[model samples]
Target chain A: MNTDDLIDFLATRVEAVDPGRQDRLLTLAMAGSLCLAALACIFALGVRPDLLRAMGTFDFVLKVGFLAAMVAIAAHGLRRAARAGRASGKLLRLALLPLALVWFAAVMQIVATPATSGMATMFNDWFVCVLAIPLLSVIPLVVLTLVLRETAPTDLHYCGALLGLVAGGIGALAYASFCVNDAPVYVGIWYAAGLAIVTGFGWLTGPRFLKW
Target chain B: MSREPDLEALMRASQSGDAEAHRALLQHVSVRLRSYFRNRLRRSGAGTDDAEDLVQDTLLVLHTKRHTYDGSSPVLAWTYGIARYKLIDHLRLNARALRNVQIDEMDDLADVDRYEAVDTSRELHRALDTLPRHFRLPIEYVKIEGLSIAEAAARIGMTDAAVKIGIHRGMKKLAALLSEARP
Candidate 1:
């Protein structure tokens, strides 16, 4: 058909779009998926018996608190950057702040630990956690990417990494419930490593999966 | 492109499933697409009707993908992004068709490529002439010639870092000048 004629026809045929509705639907899907994932972990892996005791401690609070903060900041940034033409450096920095604090706390713990102290305690579950966090993040990470299919991301790779951070952050929080080791070093090393791996995975997949 | 228009409000209304708002938004985008495609086709030695066909395809894609457009994004960018993908798809289909037709003509095209490259290189040189020597040298060596940073550094008699900075600034200025020169 001719251009003008087609334009006239399209004028009548065009359907109203509801991006806000889609955004709300994405939220519902992600939240429901995370809940299901957490439940699965609890039922299959069993919550750590000392979880209640650990929750009451200051150190434990700080650890989970850092991850919680990551979820908050990353989630906010992900939502913003998911939009077109949104190159929000401020949001990226805001998301990194929580991670930086966690790293800082970990460094301080390393410094304070006696050089003579056995290395076994410090390295406990370090390798295992590096593997575990990414695996745990798979469900939520997939959910996040699926949710993002409805939105436009200008910097696809960065957006994927950001959402990966969100999933990893939330996944770590879920995993924490079953973990007994509350050391700053463990959280710093394992949690950070796990999220890094996921972020890397997102970077590789972002350009391919999130290109649309 | 029409920042003065209340695009956000219009977009929000469309997001609420207001048919009139949706129609208005689509019509607005359709107008922009017409001009965009016409300009692109003119530059690419294609017919204006190709623009219409592509624009129609873009709208269809947009209709299917409307829910993906987050309400907060600039409609222009989002719309253009989808248009770009549609353009790519169209080009790919055309390319495949042309490849079949040109099965025996590929060899002759090599000569055309060389001639075009020479003309392009001369034009590029003219553009580079406007840049300062410090910026131009590094860009020519590292960017155009595809020289390593160390090679560029040695040729320009500058540190690797200085060469990198010069190439960066030179490219940015060249891009600005080139874009300004174009419609």
Candidate 2:
């Protein structure tokens, strides 16, 4: 079409633009997907039998909190990625704080405990943790990808990667309740590994699917 | 030449559903994009006709993504961002296609008559036909037939909001289709 014709096409019958529409849509979609992931995790894996008892522990709270923080950061980054020219490298830098904090806690815990005990806790259910987290992430990742296509994202790679992180974070959080390994070292290793897999999935598929 | 502030004001007014303001904003934007694309295309050794297509593609993206403007940045900056993305995308697609040229075809590439003029509207219509009916009808009615959203909604038997959404989504899908069709 001619440029003028295209202009006329777009300018006709314009509606009042809702500035918050994308933000609202993304937040609702993410919330709904996270809820779906949580439910799926609960039903499929079953929550740890001593769930209430686990909630009282320091390591459990830290583990859950770490995942929650990652999700929040990724969501923020995703919001930035949705807008044209708004993506910033600073968000990635900010995310390093949480990474450093979790690793610091893990290191301290490792140093405090005997090497044998720390290593044993770190490997508990490692296989199940990695596999199950990605499985749980499937719903949120797919949902977020679909929702993301409705908005314009220039940095498809960043946007896709953030979606993966958000999905993975939710998956990890859901898995936290069911996980028996509460050691900071275990969380620092196994949980990070699972999240990285999802994030890698996002990074690889981002340029293909997020393009629009 | 339209000043940035004037364009920004037009953008703000356009956001409030003022069709005239939107038209005015887009006219200015089209002028800017034409020159922008022309310069970039010249630099990249691409045809000026491709610039026209890129201008239209970027405009479509801007139209569909207007709500993401947020007004925190200059309107031109936002426009330039989308324009840059379209330019890069076009160049990248061209490069990929160029990579597939056989050594035998390389000899024929020097022929002046080898290229055909791009028929944008025909291609656009072909692209539109590929969209789902729900997404296509609202665009055909409101954009092509020049019907208002309410009128289109009534005829399509969808709610007005649905019609609006359909048009928005249809435009996005159309833009994607156009992008894939880029020469």
Candidate 3:
């Protein structure tokens, strides 16, 4: 086909862009996601009674720090992922920085508290931690996908991975309040696993749902 | 006259379901992809129809993905990215399929005539279209179909010398046609 004729034929099928579509859609998506996750956390599992005490410890800061960093960095990537063929090359590095730091802290934490009586109990509820992170991420994942659908992303795998990071981070953050255990190693090991599972899910779904 | 050839403006109008704007956008995108698809297809020695097929498929992709175009990025980069990805997917699928033929059944599939007439055929390949049937058939059997000159001569019922000359003249004409196509 002649290029001109082909273009004319295709252009006739296009629909107009609505004013302020991207901004309006994203704003609602984030707000709705947070509200939904927070609600689920409150009704399903109340915040740990000792959350204030947990907040005062350095471990709380470190644990929350890792998740918060993931959320902040991944959110930045979400915007760029909106463009086709564009992906944040920094996402992996940004995600790893916090995780590595926490892992280091976990090592120090174990060395400092070795052979403690409560050490055996630390691994208790480990399954629950793994289950809760991705389970809790479902709503945010759905909500983020709604916004993602509105943007044109070319690299579906990278963009989907970034979305997974963002949704997983939010889930981990919400779960932090209910979680009383602040062992850096546990957070490093189990929490990291949970996030990985979420990220893997994102990668699996990227090609199917993020085609646009 | 049309106000101006504004792709972004056309995209904006397209979001509102305007067929005129959609047509303009498709034309603009197709003009760009013509070169994009041609470059890759030519590299693989694929026929011109392959390039047109890619363009049409891209147009459909753009239509389906129309809602995702946010207009914040350059339209060329956006469409070009999509075209590139489509090319990658096209190559990936073709590569796998071609691999089995090339490795496992190269002898049997060697020189298969892709130019054979099909009932549904509607367009001519630019390079082959200009040659007369006699010249075209000889060249195709010898070159594209991988038949030796004697083999082609036996098949076409012509002397090997005449078959060789037909192929040579046909090739010269095909070259002229291809050269003309470039500029």
Local distance difference test, each candidate: 0.68, 0.82, 0.72
In model 3, state the lDDT of residue A192.
89
lDDT of 1 by residue, A1-212 (tens): 34443334333323345566655765676677668667767876789898888889866887899888887787777877676556556775676677677778767776887755634566776776676677778888878778787566667677877878877877777788777777776777678788778777877787778855
Evaluated with DockQ, which candidate comes out highest? 2
TM-score of model 2 vs. true structure: 0.87
Instruction: Estimate, for each residue in A110-150, the C-alpha lDDT of model 3 and write its tens digit.
Output: 77776574377569689988999998899889998987875
lDDT of 3 at B3: 50
Model 2 deviation from the true structure expressed as Cα RMSD, one decimal place = 3.9
Deviating ranges (above 4 Å) for candidate 3: A1-6, A9-20, A111-121, B1-28, B60-73, B91-183
Higher-DockQ candidate among 1 and 2?
A: 2
Measured against the true two-chain complex, the DockQ scores of the candidates, in the order shown, are 0.15, 0.61, 0.20
TM-scores for every candidate against the unseen true structure: 0.67, 0.87, 0.65
C-alpha-based local distance difference test score of model 2: 0.82
Q: What is the TM-score, restricted to chain A, for candidate 2?
A: 0.94
**Stronger candidate by lDDT (1 vs 3):** 3
Clashes of 2: 0
Clashing pairs in 2: none
Interface RMSD (Å), each candidate? 15.6, 1.7, 12.1
TM-score, cand. 3 = 0.65
Ranking by DockQ: 2, 3, 1
Chain A TM per candidate, in order of listing: 0.87, 0.94, 0.86
